[model samples]
Target: MSAERVHRTTHDVTVAAPAGVVYGLISDAVQWPLYFPPNVHVEQLEFDGERERLRMWATANGEVKSWTSRRVLDAVARRVEFRQELPARPVRSMGGTWIVEPLGADRCKLTLLHDFTVDGDDPGAVAWVERATDTNSTAELANIKALAERWANLDELVLTFEDSVRVNGPAELVYDFLHRVADWPELVPHVSRLDVVEEEPGVQVMSMDTLTADGSSHTTESVRVCFPDAGRIVYKQTATPLLMSAHTGEWTVEQDETGATVVSRHSVVLREENIERVLGEGATVAAARRYVREALGRNSTATMNLAKSHAENAVTVL
Candidate 1:
């Protein structure tokens, strides 16, 4: 009932913000990609009250790794505890807890705790854990602190841009066209390659390579959670573009008397430090914003138009 060998690490950060704001960031595991730097995608597999199962992909020690975790959420206690369903190699067991404590009005203390055990005291393995624990825990704390403090003015750091097209056909046709991203490589001109892996129903991991208007290319990975009944698919990019430090968005279909509207909403947070190097020297945030908006808008508009054509020309099943 107990682990043979044990190792532990703890990281604490004090933030000048309310506990609820910080806790909200941690409690919503699906949104981690948007708030936490290392998190690429988190898919909720099952949830019932305080118990939940999730699949997460994240960068640890500078390498990407995916794992399934079982979590126990305690909202009243402001705490969450989780453990890997199947621990990674060289480890017998892995578990962690997050706790948020209120210091006073507009102040809080966040704590991250990790407990684990390896086969033996392999220095290399132990060192890796130490480095990862320090790096990721500290980063999650710092990100929450900055986001909470600037929550009111986050528009300066994060931006949401969208493009939509109205199709003169049934909503089901439009939804089906957008949902089948695997067909985009052949159907959409800008999409050079699209690979999708669906290990479970309604949850998918996709890798897409896109060519922008300027001919520059980039590959991005994402996890998408589909809701056919609602005609919505929410996705978070695990691998982001050069200008965006993190990205998450959704595809939504809305129907009215006229027709159906398919929309692509992209929410991006810029990497200020890389702006000059990425966009060339002396490029400001404003310049980055304009450049990114135009580039993303072009691709989205292209996809929506493609969808519009497919829906308008195809036979409607609904």
Candidate 2:
């Protein structure tokens, strides 16, 4: 049999931050959805100090794809090497390395390298892989540069919080309520409009319009991955509100002695430049943070309450 053709590419950017900071960003795969635009979700399958396994979901040429990867991390050298254990379609094998070279005390060069082979070395498949790799690598590098440059304010720029409710019914019902988001417009008061499509089972692409306290609305598009057996759903917003640069969230339901507990978790990266434009002339980052926290908490809490009612009512009817 003939050997498959291999293609290689390299992408890099200069970051205005320390090599350690840049390396930290690349080493944490679980936080990719929050930092990188194309990533939808990442699950850590296993880790033993320097080596780890990850299951990742991301968009390739506007299509959602999932794969598992093994990665080796070297903090001292500021390098991470990764190989896809189970590459997605059109990709037979894929591997990459991230190298962070220190330029100065607060400057570094971040480089990403990729080498991959297509399933059958088909021209069309090779082209697709090339385009996807180029697009994703460009976006990832840009994101790292932007975030690393603002290392001083990252604490104020990034936020994470969650809200939960106790439900006196089955966990499945709660999962059902959240999974069927298309019905949210009718079931949830704050949701003005919602459209969802699932081209692949358990993977949803949705656009939603939600109302604020002042009667204004904002639209967001998101990709969601559902785990039925685990009673969890994870999502990342591709389109965000004016005040947010990025948003990712999770919905979880766990059964307990009494019934179940439903939780909604949210992580957001604030758009500092738009804070005053969105909230008024004198709005500060703290004010923006408070406003966002209240607004998201209210919406998630409302949904959780309704989900609780839906499950409890179903139990009552049965």
Candidate 3:
């Protein structure tokens, strides 16, 4: 029998940042959802400082796919190598390396290389895998370059915060309330309209219209992954508000001695160019940060409160 065919591709970018900085950004897979457009979430399953295992979820050609990866990080060499432990469908095997080469004191060359074999070595499967790898690799490289170049201002551009409430009831009810987001339009006051599609179990694609404090409405679309047993739901907003370039969040329910605590966490990247237009003239990044924090916190707090009520009232009624 002939050897199986393997496809190889490489994508590279020049980043106006230190090699160490670029390496740090690529090594920390947990924060990828915040920085990379294609990545939705990453869970670090195992880590031993230099070697790690990760469970990652990402969008490929508009569809969400998940896989487990084993990574080896070499900080001194500014390189990272990864192989998919369980490649998603259409892919038989996938592995890649990231190399960050220092060009100057404050410049680096970032390169991504991928090699993969398709299931059955079918032409259609090979093409699909090629497109996905190309799309995701290009996006990842571009995002790394953009963020690395702006490392100095990352603090001003990225915002993260959380809101929580104590529910005087079972964690299951609270999780149920969060998981059934399709009912948010009637149950949540700020959610004026919502459409949810769940083609795959535990994965949701939602389009929602939310009313602001000023009575205006804005629409957003998101992909959400739910973990019922863990009482956690993580989501990335593919479509964001005027002031945000990217947004990702999580809802978690924790059970304690007294009752359950529900928390909502939000991480947002500001659109600096839209700040003046959205918040009026002379608005600084700080102002935009505060505005976004307040707006998102307010909505999250509302949702948390309602979830608490739903859980508590359900217990009371029963």
Which candidate number maximizes lDDT? Answer: 2
TM-score pick, better of 1 and 2: 2
TM agreement with the true structure for every prediction: 0.68, 0.98, 0.97
How would you encode candidate 2's per-residue C-alpha lDDT over 1-318 as one tens digit per residue? Answer: 668998999999999998989998999999999999999999999999899999999999999999999999999999999999999998999998999999999999999999999877999999999999999999999999999999899999999999999999999999999999989999999999999999999999999999999999999999999999999999999999999999999999999888999999999999999998999999999998999999999999999999999999999553
Candidate number that wins on lDDT, 1 or 2: 2
Give lDDT per model, in order: 0.84, 0.96, 0.92
Candidate 3 lDDT over 295-316, as tens digits, reads: 9999999988888888898885
Q: List the residue pairs that clash in candidate 1.
A: none
**Alpha-carbon RMSD to native, per candidate:** 5.6, 1.1, 1.3
- The lDDT, on a scale of 0 to 1, for candidate 3 is 0.92
Q: Rank the candidates by lDDT, best first.
A: 2, 3, 1
The lowest-lDDT stretch of 10 consecutive residues in candidate 1 is 57-66
Task: Give stretches of model 3 more than 4 Å off.
Answer: 1-3
